[model samples]
Structure formats: structure tokens, C-alpha cells
Target: MAGLKPGAPAPQAITVHGQSRVLEIAFSDGAVFRIPFELMRVYSPSAEVKGHGPGQEVLQTGKREVGLLGLDPVGNYAVQPRFSDGHDSGIFSWDYLYHLGSQQARLWADYERRLAEAGVDRDAPMAAAGGGACGHHH
Candidate 1:
């Protein structure tokens, strides 16, 4: 998928399927994806999850119980996720979301490696990490 240009219209609809743990995003440009919540959480664009730069990323664990509580639009380019556990800071831009969707496999593998190094289970209870339980931004 090509990168989304700045100022382009954002997605037309974003739906969270609680039972499937998937987020369905439909863009005005006709791209659509049913992204799993685990994929979204593990690939959150927040600095806490993405880190300040490459190699600083913190792996997310215990996010199996997490869910998207709501989606709040941020201006014209991004959406703020109201996570079920009350996390609402990450402003997921259209470009970022698309990138994550395109690079899901690589990102998931990296996240799994980090979790292994941290001795954490991706589906277990949250540990006492600096960030919130699931490691997303506060």
C-alpha cells in the first residue's frame, strides 16, 4: 500500500468488534482492514510503545484482555483510541495505522521477541512496568 498523503481525508468508519477483538477501518480512499486488537495494541504509535526511536520500543504484554472502548477523532488526520482499560492518549494517524496494517507480521514478530526478553507473556496479566499494564501510553 502507498503511503497516505498528509491532509488527505481520514478513514470514513472505524468499528471495534468486541467479540472478534478486531478493529475494522474503512478509509475514504477505499482501503479497508479488519485488524486484530492485539495487532493494534502491539503496534500502538504512542511513544511509550514505539519508544523515542528505533530499538527503544517496549514490548506490550498482557493485552489479551484489552479492547477498544471508543474512537475519538483528532482533527483531520488521526483518531484517539479510548481503550477499555482507560488508555486514551495515543493519536493513531491514518498513515500510521496503514503502515501497521501493512507491516503486521514483522511488527508482531518483533513484539514477541521483546516479550520473550522481558520474560512476559503476551496474554498473561500485566506486569509492573513503567508504562501502563499493557505498555501503551497513559
Candidate 2:
């Protein structure tokens, strides 16, 4: 009866830093995180990014300069981030945001490793031979 009660974590300030290509979020718990747009894009919660299930994840490559186009409220429980890369399906919840912030360094490293293993570059434009499909440029 002396600890914090169960409740939704509140985000004090959420900002899209275009200059730095990062999304800054400050929590009520006094934690502040500057998450790179590229990171969010690669780790997007959208089915397109995460896929319908494991082992089907589409590896997102060449998003080093991604930008945050906008953030919209999704029932006060989460925010939808629209990226300059045209990805806006991920609804980042408060808990997920916190996790991203806390685990950023490690997650990013893993992503880099995966990219290297896949022979991909973070800044190279991604192109695949998919007929009539939108390709990633830059």
C-alpha cells in the first residue's frame, strides 16, 4: 500500500525533431528519450513492419534519414506516427514507448547486426524486383 498504483503511464511532452530526425518523449516519471525516426520506422508496430507473426517480419532497410511527418492521438492510449517514408500504421502505446526508450541502444545494435548479416546498409536506397510495387528510395 505504499507504492504507485496501477495506472496508465502519462507522456508529458512528445515532440518531433525534424532537425535531428528524432522523436522526443518525456514521461511523467522524469524519463526522457530521444528515439531516432529510423529506429521507429524499422521497429514499427504495424503489421507491415512487424508482420502478422514472427518469422514473417519484413526487414526494413535504408531508413537512416527517415523523418516524423506527424503524430495523431489514438484514443489517448497511443499515438500514430506518420513518417516521411509513408509509414503510419504503427500505434505506439505508452508502455511500448517506454520500452523503446529504455531499450534503444541494445535494440539499435541488434538491428545493425541483422542488417549486416542480411548484407544491407542503413543509408543505401532499398530496391527489390517487385513489379508495380512502391520501392524505397533513400
TM-score of each: 0.77, 0.85
Candidate 2 ranges beyond 4 A from true positions = 1-5, 128-138
lDDT (Cα, tens digit) per residue for candidate 1, span 6-71 = 666467888889988888888777878777877777777787677777877767677777888888
What's the lDDT for candidate 1?
A: 0.75
Best by TM-score: 2
Candidate 1 RMSD computed on C-alpha atoms after optimal superposition onto the true structure: 4.9
Error of 1 at 71 (Å): 0.8
**Whole-model lDDT values for every prediction:** 0.75, 0.81
For candidate 2, the 10 contiguous residues with the lowest summed lDDT are: 129-138
Candidate 2 lDDT tens digits, 66-111? 8888999887668899998788989888888888999999999989
Q: What residue runs in model 1 are displaced by over 4 Å at the alpha carbon?
A: 1-9, 129-138
